[model samples]
Target: MLKRIWTIFIRDLTVNMREFMTLYMIIIPLVLAVGINFLSPSINDTSVNLALIENENPEQAAYFDDFANVELFSDEQKVEDRVMSRDSVAGILPKDNGYYIMTQGNEPESVLEYAKLLNVLYEADVQLEDARSEIIEFGRTVPPLKKMLVNMLLLLISMLAGMLIAMNILEEKVDQTVSAINVTPTSRSAFILGKSLTGMAVALFSSIACLLITGFYNVNLGQAALVVFSSTILSLLIGFIQGLNSDDVMEAAGSVKLMFLPMAGSIAGYEFVTGNWQIFFYWSPFYWAYKANDMILSKSGTWPQLILFIGIILAICGAVYALLAPRIARKLQ
Candidate 1:
């Protein structure tokens, strides 16, 4: 049966090669989103046309340097006018000891976007200063700041790969291939493995290729690889299962939007984007994947933690597959 499934896997590849649809489903993403992510310009220019106030202190000015392109304006009104005219992205104005971020919009609201970042940086500088003073200069290496980088990877990974797997399966279903293979004696287990392998192969290959092209970033090799692969396969399998549940290709593709929020939100913890506990995220495979990825990328986790992270996802995938196999078999009957 395993041999047969392997043969079927090869057959799937041949069929995939011959079909422009399958090729398009996988190749288009690689050439587009993933390609663009690596090729796009960096956001290094945090500089903004910022205007400071009369009561500005050196401490505040230091903060602005971290997040904005600081340009001084004499009055808050001038800053407001520039913002209203769309001449500037944001403006910093003075109030008392601190300043207020005045933004110009039809709603006449304040956009502390850049200002808030500056404030955070300034506060960080102050905290660091205090720490330095307190430590009596206790020699310590500053930990590498890996920003919400982990979240971005998880969001991109699960969504992209999940959408692909789901869409591909939905396409196969729409084409009546799922119905065609319903009569196979090798069982639904074999059939699913065959399809799962197809999607996994695409995701795994694309991920590795993308990483290779961009050059590896701040991630531990063995731990990260294991975590990423496990999570990716689980995500792909879940996506495939969801795609199979769809009645048609368009329906399946549209379903990707439904999965987006959960997948992206689930990774919020990986990047610490929101302190709000997304309870729904607990159920998302991508969340676990993101958590696991965080360990590898940050190199802050122990071996047991890494194992549990990767291992649990694999177990979940196995469980989901087992549960699905019986249902698929009954449907075949």
Candidate 2:
């Protein structure tokens, strides 16, 4: 039975490789991962921008470089040019052993004040060790934007798994091979499992590749994979139902794509809706998956929390499967 399932999976993989859409689904996640990596800012990156004449005061320029985004200019005119440009940049010009803060006047008051404060501290020769402030750590290293984007990408890849299944099923139907499944030695159960393998493989492969490409190497892959695996249940069910009912791959894929509506709602609800309003998203497996993925990516996920999320996802998927099973069976016949 395992061998038969493997053979079916291999055949489906070969067929999917020959199709452009299937290849696009497989490659798109990695491409998006690169984009996300390039766009997402690091956790330590600051929003403050400062322009300095390095030759005028190298000491101040070096000090400010450690705190803000400092741009060095050869003279005061260049510094003024940079500060007056579109971007908000505060210029500190040296005059008679004192410093002058230069801005476009339209720049934010907070930025002007921050530049003044930094100059005041420098003039006072303030030392970090003298302050003796103790720092507390929460151990969260990944930026929130990057974490959210990666989680969304993972969810997308999981749904694409079901789409792959739908495409494979459509191919079989188009070739008039689905009707002959029973006549062959392969059971319906084996055929279903065989068809699912490619989707699962693609989902898992794309997910891992995305994580690695997006600089999530430190994330707990085992915990992340569990969330991804559990979330695929609803999509796979939808894929099978749509694939069985539709006349072509595009129709089946279109129906499967409709699953994104609830997914987007769930993510938005979980992230934005607070207090009692969050209950509205509990029905979606994606909400749980997002929670689990967020915890995992942030390195705060516990085994118990992961298990609870996975259980909820399975429960939701199971309910959906129970409701759709009869329809899928009829279509299969």
Candidate 3:
């Protein structure tokens, strides 16, 4: 039985490698993750082009010392014009403590950081007036960079798992190998496991590629591997389930994407934006998986918690696999 399963897994993996599109699906997320990381310079290095609408009580531009290129504007119209022309990221309003953000599109993380900087400067302005010696607390109150980085990692990981597994199964269906494998001694569960294992392999390789490319030396390989492993299984389970209703690869891809829309949204803003939205995270497997991976990588979790989280992930994947197995069997028949 083990030999037969190994054969099945090997065949699936071999087929996945030969498919030209397989290379695209496997590497695209890595590029997105690495590209986003590389192209966008670190927040610390990026300049904040700012404009100040000199307030009635404002001193003659002596306070704005920390940021890059703080320009002076006489009125709201000038500030608005500068922002509309993409001249600056932020503007100090005519009123004290009021800052105007230029635009909300393109790299929300960048925009939010700029907002925090402006807010910090505003707080200092307030303190200087009151003759208080308080140090302005700003960026620390926002989500930490470490948390945001973890969140990005989890999103990319989940996406990698979901796309690699789901799409590969669809490719099998398209090439008619899924039906051929059905003639083997492969039980539906065993067959699913085989393909799931292949997906896990692809996801792990992607992670390694990320490590190699970025030299992110700090990853807790053991825990990260576990998370990727579990996530790949779930992705494979979803693929098998969606394949039942899809006669071709494209339909299967669409079905899988539709299935994971909720998860996708959670991936976009899980910890950074919706960390406190407990009710929102309830339906998202990505959220729980992210939490589990986070704990493992950060060393913030007890062993039991890791076990419990992995167990729950396995259980959820198992329950889903079990329910979908019969349906898949019926569909194949």
Candidate 4:
């Protein structure tokens, strides 16, 4: 039975590799991961941006770099051009041994104020250590925005696993190979397991790759993998149903994608809603998955909490599977 399942899995994998859509699905998560890493600001990064004529005011520019994001330009015109660009950047130009701050007039008040404060401090000969400021640590190293983006990517990739399964099954149906399963010494259980392996593997690989690429090396992989694995149950069921019921690739893909609605709703509720309103999202397995992922990313997830989330996810998936089993079996026949 294992050998039969392996054969089926290998065949499905080979066929998927030869197809453009499957290859695309496999590559897109990594690309998105790199994008997220590049776009997300570090926890210590300052929001204030300063454009300075470096050749004219090298010392001032060096001083400003410690407090804000300083973009050095060799000429005043370049500094003015940078300040006028889309992003909120304040430019400081030298004039008659004094400096003047230039703005596009639409920059945030805080940015302009911050640039003014930095310039004042520089002219006053105030060094950073002279301020006598003490830094306190609450021990959260990961930025919230980056963590949220990574978590969303993980959830979307998990859903994509189901899509992969649906596509694989749809291919079998289209090629008329699904009808040959029973006649080819493959049990129905073997066939299902074989079909599931590719989706599961893709989900695991993509999740891990996203984490590593996004600099989440310190995250608890065991906890993350457990949550990811448990989260796939519902998607896998949906994939099977969509694959069996749909007559073509487009219909299967389209139907499977409807799962995103609840996913988005759950994430929004978790992030935005508070107090008693939070109970409204408890019904969604994704809400629990998000909660689990959040805790995992923050390095604050306890084993009991992890277990509870996984249990809720699996219970929800089991109930869904129970409700759909008869229909799935009928479709198989």
Two-way TM-score contest, 3 vs 4, winner: 4
lDDT of 4 by residue, 1-333 (tens): 999989988998888889999888888999999999889877876479988876776788788888888898888888888988987899988888888999999987988999899889999999977898879988788888999999999999989999999999888788888778878888888899998988988899999999999999899988999999999889999999999999998999999999999999999999999868999988899999999999999999799999999999999999999998888778776
On residues 1-333, what C-alpha lDDT tens digit does candidate 3 reach at each position? 667667767886676667766666776757765764655444354576666676633552445534356777788788767766633356556454454455424435765576566566666655445555666756432124544554455546555565556666666666777678778777766776666666677778776566445434465677767777776677766766676567776776677677466665655555557546665665566766777766654556776887777777788778877887788777655
Itemize residue pairs with steric clashes in candidate 2.
Answer: none
Runs of candidate 3 exceeding 4 Å displacement: 39-153, 171-190, 211-215, 272-277, 296-299
Pairs that collide in candidate 3 are none
- Give the per-residue lDDT of model 1 (tens digit) for 1-333: 787678667776677667676667567545654544544423342245566654556567655655456665666676666677744456666567655666654421233565666665565665444543333533211122322343354446545566666765666676777666766666776876776666666666665554444334544555655665677665665576668688866676676657667666665544565546645466666777777665554556799988876777788778876877665455434
Where does the lowest 10-residue lDDT sum fall in candidate 1? Answer: 138-147
For each candidate in the order shown, give its overall lDDT on alpha carbons.
0.60, 0.87, 0.63, 0.90
lDDT of 3 at 37: 66
Better of 1 and 2 by lDDT: 2
CA RMSD (A), model 3: 6.8
Please estimate how well model 3 matches the true structure, expressed as its whole-model Cα lDDT: 0.63
- Output the better candidate (3/4) by lDDT: 4
- Cand. 1 Cα-lDDT: 0.60
